[model samples]
Target: MSAVLRRSRKSPAKDGPAARRDIPPGMRPPPLEPMRNPGLSRARLLDMHRFLRLNRVLEDQLSALYRQGKIVGGLYSSLGQESISVGTACALEPGDLLAPMIRNIGSLLVRGVPPLSLFLQFLARHAAPTAGKDGTLHFDDPGRSIIGPISVLGTLIPVMTGAALAARMRGESRVALTYIGDGGTSTGDFHEGLNLAAVLGLPLVLVVENNGYAYSTPVDRQFAVDSLAERGPAYGIASESVDGTDVLAVYAATQRAAARGRGGGGPTLLECRAFRRRGHAEHDDMWYVPRDIVAAWEQRDPIDRFESFLVEQGHATKGDLRSVEENLAAELDETARQALGSPYPPPEETLRGVYAGGD
Candidate 1:
């Protein structure tokens, strides 16, 4: 339960649906119903709004760092697609595993990766979780049940499939979830992983973020099917689609899917229909994307849409949303500043993990 919602339910005067009953008899409106299916509490909805803002602010900061030549490599942003990751991560339990792609910084944060560690990875600092061995958002924390993304596009699918199988063998009530791009679905590993998971009935969830393009390649050129979820049926897996811009909708779908997986059902494929508002990486101009396409997606911006929903539903006020942005902005600012000051790995540490030593 969310903190605010808990507080509200404790008192009838200030929160929940009952508080609105104080309006004049003629002015009183119909009671606001809780969201269906997942039934997320008011506080959880507000937290989703906060995560959406944090994801956007963090990526925006990374873009600025890249332009200033402060970051070591290409900076990838999930600019228009924050809800999928944040929503899905919110649905997961503590022991559940996650293998997120480049666009899943929101998921990492939701899974407890500190803002400073994320910036440190971008800075390629010795202080990073990966100790400068890997640049970008490619660090893993197995102890935390979060594995870093592999650069080989669809490879993480198979890697997570292995984890799912391991969980089943260990009799653990854990599901392994992984993110992949629309382009990644064409990879052999994607098929192999999903196929194996279906055959063995592994608790795996595949989230395909179909952001319209595979870097520069458009979706029409990539697959014949109109929706990526369509491919799930062929693999004998259940699948569904959701409005990627709506945080509550995404959370509801993911929560159901994750529950199904943990309940001994096979994998589920969720195709999130969203657009990448930025280039594949900061270096590309994204000139290939149509201006009208970008404009259309901008209007459906996930954070903005969710914030509006929260306010319209009386769950959060404009001031409440603004407070979230301000807090995250300050937090991200300090995170970047400290990361920029962190040192690089020393030459002596270069070969530390390169080879095995004899016992």
Candidate 2:
């Protein structure tokens, strides 16, 4: 046998006995069991379901705001990529930073940004996170320690790389996570950013959320590789391809990746396999998506997949799931409604933070 194959299969116990051990009634197997491919625990699975459900609630609220004209300008929203946000953010400590993309509403919420502030930002209202400057996108959150949701595509990579470099210099071990789409992977800044992170061994997490499309272009048309996860090794970073819709899978992979970063092991590249259920933006007609293909990926919706996982793993009952969804919806609705009733940013303070290190 080839060396790689032999090493991968040299389990202490035989494949049959070890793999087919009978569990006692309802009890599930332990998580973190070493294998060729690792899986998540029942608890993790339950958490994932809750996270995505909450995400859907938030998305609904945002959609309502847009429909009501309370939300202004472009909304580069993402409804289906909830697992990347929920899974990775859940794994972070209090002080960690998320340098996000335009579609990272879930990441902001999970990182402890107030839902009201998120709504206000969407509305371009005063106290709108960015003080009404940013429209329908969030970035300014001192309370949550989030740096941004840069709208100009891949430019955030270099800025995030610098942030990670600064953290390393300041002796702060907090990990900085930055997202790149499959399309962003080809940008010069992406390469430059990752190259520096790897060389400096910066404590950073680089997540490539491969949702099969970047804007409107499919992965097959953009790249030759099967998974974006393969790019990590080129930068000498430890990496993995996770089932992005399964929040548990994303969480497990991120936890391991973050550990690799903070343990002085440098950066870790993670590819989150997800689907873009919504259009590129509200303005898009989404004519590029084939009807059959959309239907197929939609069937594997992350939130639904996770609910089944919860039931199959015996982590949650139907009532428990319902309660979680109900509570989250109520909370999100309150936040959004309150935002609608709130005041806008003062016109006098319009030019506030353009220049830093001053009052």
Candidate 3:
């Protein structure tokens, strides 16, 4: 069996009776075992660290922008789930394709998307990826093999399955990876896409971010399955559940899944167990989530955990990490300034690219 499958079956029981017994009933699961280092080099580990920090910091800045009324649309904050985005994206090869959800901005950054582009996109600046036409994460960078997200949840599964099929037909060794939230997994598109991928043996990987609540609804009310990973076998695919807060574990699971897909083993369903610390969007106050759950997840903050790992393992010093953060803070400040200064699309150009050959 694959590592992902094995991990899913034998996950440690630390969170069940011992740690979280006094906590509320919903969203409680066994605590994740400490993930072994995946043997990443010092530089790569540092890069992962930077990506995790950048993901949080960038979102923090965007939240500030939203509060100041500078942003055009709803701002989604991936406050507590940075590892799921960064770790999985970092596991992909150069030619692999990934479709990022709204909260997976870290994946975009890991794929070399400049912070300025995100700021521009959110600010509705002219030079944004959508050319100021859309204010959300609806832009794609084909050059970097990053597919923009569709607004409908779970729809990207079929889109990415098709992309994987196209790559296979073209005789290219590429894998397509996409993500869905716990709520999205219940959608028809999720079932149809995963079924097709399983039947056709497409080089695809589906990451299910089971982040506690599906927009205020707890996991107990979402589905009857004890673990979402169980859904993989019903579709005849490999599946695994990992502590989404552990960046190394997430990276390792994705790496195995991607390798299996590339090696013609078809699709793998990866369930990343995490907690969404914020509301569905910035507008939400998350009144439904229990305070105890929030406090527990905050203690497992992915960035803080990874920072300690880097320092304890001698991969980086406190000063080194501090410098990385300082530099990133400076970069984001400049990027936000430039994006704010950019011009918006003129009225005449509103329909310029709306029709074919109109540009």
Model 2: per-residue Cα lDDT over 230-272, one tens digit each: 8888888888887676666777788888888889998888988
lDDT of 3 by residue, 296-334 (tens): 889889988898888899888899999988888888988
**In candidate 1, how many clashes are counted?**
0
Question: How far is each candidate from the true structure, as Cα RMSD in Å?
Answer: 13.7, 13.0, 8.4
Candidate 2 TM-score over all chains jointly? 0.83
lDDT of each: 0.81, 0.72, 0.87
Q: What is the lDDT of residue 336 in candidate 2?
A: 79
lDDT of 1 by residue, 1-359 (tens): 14434543455433433233332221111122333336878877777777788888998898899889898877888988898899889988979999889899999988888889999998988999888888777988887799888689999988999998888888898999999988899999999999999999988999998888787677766787877888889999889977777667778778788988988889999988888888778775565555566787787877787777778888889998898899889988988988899999997777787667711
Off by over 4 Å in 2: 1-48, 356-359
- In model 3, the clashing pairs are 15-31
Which candidate leads the pack in lDDT?
A: 3
Which runs in model 3 stand beyond 4 Å of their true positions? 1-26
Candidate 1 residue pairs that clash? none
State the local distance difference test value for candidate 1: 0.81
